[model samples]
Target: MTQGLDIEQMLAQHIARLKASLQQASGEGSGPEEGSDAWLLLNAFVENDPQNWHTLLANFEQSGHWLAEQGGKLDVRIVALQRYIDALVAELKQILSEQPLLLVETVERLHLLQSESIQALTRGYQSVTDQCLRDKDMFSQQLEHRLLALQRINGVSNSAMDLDQTLEITAQAIAEELQVDLCSIFFYDDMQRVLTLRATNGPRPLGGMHFTQRIGEGYSGWVAEKGQSLLVHDVMASPNFASEVQAYSSDYHGLMSLPIIFFGDAERLIGVISVLSQEPRDFTREEISFVEIVAGIIAINVENGRLYEQTDEQLRRKVHELATIHRVSSVIASTLNLDEVLQMITTQAVHLSGAERSCIFELDPDRRRLHVLAHYGLNANLVGQLYINVGQCCAGRTVQTGRPSMAVDCFHTDEHCFIRSDPFISSEIHSVLCVPLKVKDKILGCLCVYSSHRHLLSAEQMQLVNLFANESAIAIENARLYEETRRGLELKSVLLRELHHRVKNNLANVAGILSLQRRRSKSSDVRHILAESVNRVQGLAATHDLLAHEDVSEARVDEVARKIVGVASTNLVPPEKHITFKVEPCGIVIPSRAVTILALIINEMVSNAIKHGLAGQSVGRVIVRGREEDGWVYVQVSDNGTGPAFNLQFGENSESSSEGLGLSLIKNLAGDLEGQFSLRREHDLTSQNGTNTTGDGPAEYTVAEVRFPLVRRSRTRE
Candidate 1:
């Protein structure tokens, strides 16, 4: 419309400058059109009549108000419009140079037009701002409607380990969240082809455990059958809704059902979740999607809850089984009494096998018959009398086949376990389960437990019985082995005692023969040699006699010392010698092999003390003390007599001399004791433990001490 100026270009510039947020807030489909904002500004100049200029500005106000609100300054659009007007004026001035008055009027009108357009833009600015503010409030409300999905999931996950509780909690939470009148969870049984209402937020339409419908029979069932969601505004209007199926299901007007699908399982449907409203209601896409999400969460958590329950139950069962086995193992290890242990085994097997009465049978020596070794709840008179041939009855078959066997309805069925029907019928024995009591490859016997009622055992229960059966077999074998070993030990002890007695008698005869030779001798040297030899032989006899008396391979060191001293007093001491002997024991016990050597050592020491140390002394005292310390055994023999006339080192021996021969024997005996021997004269000899002692040693006492390693022996048992 003007020279050197494109009106549409100037309008396009201002349109590009419009606020993007304002366009976005109004939505892409809404906002200024091709002939709005800058287009309205150009309309004021495009209209020919000056009277309609304000009216055109009013039109601009209708479309350009949002632009006016966006750019409050209006500097860019105003400058563009002014430049177009200046370019138009220059062209006009050139044309109207010959008419000064008209040109002046045109300039004044252009200035007035600019002022009116600015005023129009200002009015539209304030009005559109108020409208945008109200629109902002409305848009914000829509954005806040999406629920916190994490909060919802956490609310349902609190009781997810418990399946029933999870269902109920999910139903209630979803109902409250969606603001529905009722929310119900229905579990679909593929085998039964039915949908069962397992949990509900409100009162159930039917009695609990009775609310069920075949798949595709009702609105909820249809969703499960299709594995798709269903949203019905009116439950009665639903084509799949069958009122006849359940009269109370139609109480709700609106219903929305979603298939709870296990996503991990290729979208397999697990159940159906339904929310019902008492009044007709419309569901938005957002609401439907949220409900779908809740259904999916329910599907996943339900699976987890079932798995958790199964695992927990298995763990509890394992703990119980282990505890029971431990108790049985303890009892087997605790006693060797065959009857007592068998009774305990039968009791445990009866309880474990889920039966009332139990019996343990043993294979007879002939291996053709099974006899009741121990039993619970059976006739006491029938224990040994009740016998069954191999491969005949339950217990017998178990032994014959070396496996577990069960006889069901034993009394009524063709296979009968009881020999006398009267006792079996009276006891109500209808079923019996028998398993072989075998250890390794050896079958000891069989264990039979019967129930009063017809009973069937599970595989897990049978395995438990098998475990107890193995333990019982071990017990039986252990008891038998222990009995055999005990009898063997008794026989060996008797033989040993007799051998010891015979040995003692033989030695006594030898000593008597030596005494006869000594009396028949005409030489004092021969009598002394004979006397020492007799005392040595008598000491050995005394030691063996003590072993035979105690019936053990070991004897107390003090007892051996006392016996040796008694022998020495009788053989070496004269009645007028008035020598006193005292024995003190520190409760030290040495093996029989060591005791023999110990006896010899004591005999030599005492003989030496009587013959040489206490020589020519009318009154003297001989003390034998046993002591133990730091893994060593000590035997100190002291006497208040004359000390050795000639010094004899323990390591050196002069066997040609009588006293030296005795010292040599003692040295060799100490070597056999795995010990050392020392002889000394002490001024004071007080017994360490005060077993038997005087105030002090009034004179010098000859002390002989022999020590060996101490060893503590433990009895062998299980």
Candidate 2:
């Protein structure tokens, strides 16, 4: 009886120790302090009964729950653990009070057993407490790791990386913390049956074991099939576990598997994570829960990785589209060859869309058939050989509908069905998108893209294709416009050349007729008249020479003055006569009408200067000066020899003075230039001088200054 009492005392003390440990582990200090006498007495009671620990833990959990209840929602699991410890304390106290007393010798033995039991209980409690804290620490670290993995998988800091490098990092993290021989991830193919190895960490080359296994065939496959986590205490005990393939080695023992489910609009089963260990180890709830969270994060990361890759691919394709558009525009601008332009469009379409095949189909003028103007990925012999009826293939429908058309499954479409004559059926075109190349109502051609997978075209992709096709059509039209302009310029050049030739010949003929009249004339006056006529014709011929050589349709006023003065002086008058002919340096271009009028003005003025102004003198000076002021041409011809003097009355009528024919002609030509004319004598002309010089000379010197204005013509024929 004394032994029982001693055992009860020891058990009570042990129970107190266990309760104290639980309080410390649970971070509680309200009920009992860890090193107090009550704690020691509780430990003594627990030492007599191993069941005391369970009761203690239950009581601790209940007290914790009551304490947590005031704080609203709280950790129920923690409270349960704390309550179990509190019950343990109560049970030990009850056992201590009811037990009988023991003998002194028996008491000693009981004390020894009580001490052993207390030590064992203390170790067990401490182990569980430490494990709980460790699990929490591990979960925190795992969450941080998942965040970092997601960041890496997003390619936040890098442009791209190898899949193996990404997989290795993920697998190694799971293996190292779990103390597992191997950790691997397997993904189901589109069929959802075959599993492909994605990530693994363990022995060498184990990651390389990528055998296709069915979803329900092995441990990892079973987890995926169930869409839940599984634990195998021993791989040999599992019914569905395939040791031959999944076993990292013959010594492999324990295994755990979790299915990776991605959370999104489409909650897909991405893959399965498997952990294998060399020793059979019972997995705790924390371990199982940790793996499940890790798998979920991994699923999200993988989906993010795939989306990132797709975004990068789309960016590259957009850049290529811009580059291709610029290239085609440049090609069109540089050349007028229709075939070359078509070929460029086809080749760039293939490269930009990453299509296996590409072709440009131009609509026949009558819209009856589509002609294969250019093609890439087709044999040379079949390039132009392929044509379809207007309402036949995808290209034809695009033209007929005047809208973009896309066939997700070209081989299966009811309308715009596939043509059997398509060469190179090596890769069946699962998708076909086409855009009509139309300008206003004219359908020039259709630009098409082909892909190997069905439903591959997105709205944005269709828009890009349509934009490219529009660019192609614009390029073709630009080429046509360029060709037309070039041909027009060539024709204009030919016409101008012929016009210059005919003008020169006609002037020469007039000069020849004048020469014939000059030779056949009898009287001196007749001879002079014919000679002047011949000289005028020759002046026109020289004007034509300058016009043809200088490559201009109009005559230069300054150059015409020089040529006419030069030709008239040599032919119209005697060579022995000395004359100074001078003209201003400023140039003015005159059209055909002004050319003739200005020539006549210069001709009459210069001729008058030579004939009448230098009448009785061998040496004479003639100056021709012209300037434009207020749109009027002021022309002057002066001489220093004898002719009209200051006393001479100027008459405007041609019939009044036969000597006024030259003056009359000058006045008429000036009127033709839309100008007012006035003839004036030079300053040195005979004014009221001191004395009259010699015998009545023909007259003093003469000077003719004429003003002519440029007038613009209106469309109204007046």
What are the lDDT figures for the candidates, one per model? 0.70, 0.62
lDDT (10s digit) by residue, model 1, range 219-247: 87788888888877887665568462245
- Candidate 1 — which pairs collide? none
RMSD of 2: 31.6
Q: Candidate 1 lDDT (Cα, whole model)?
A: 0.70
217 in model 1: Cα distance from truth in Å? 2.5
Q: Which prediction has the highest TM-score against the true structure?
A: 1
For model 2, what is the C-alpha lDDT against the true structure? 0.62
| Poorly placed runs, candidate 2 (over 4 Å) | 1-163, 166-169, 179-182, 196-201, 204-212, 242-246, 250-252, 350-401, 404-436, 440-465, 487-718
| Candidate 1 Cα deviation (angstroms), residue 455 | 16
lDDT of 2 by residue, 1-718 (tens): 6655665566544644556555655456654555332343254344545575455444444443444434433345334433544555444445445543333333454345334434443444455556668988988897687556545544522335565666667677667666678888888786757788876776533445665558777776677778887777888766568553344554667878888888899879888888878789887776676677667667766776777566556434543453355345434433457788777777777666657677778877777888777777766665556667776777888888888887765554444444434535524777788889876668898988877766767765665566567656766665565556577975543444333344445446545645664576444555675666566656655665665565344555677788789888888667778776666564555554566557667877788778877887777777676665777666667677655544332334333345455666566556656665555554443312323222245344456766665544322111
Clashes of each: 0, 49
Q: Per-prediction TM-score, please?
A: 0.45, 0.42
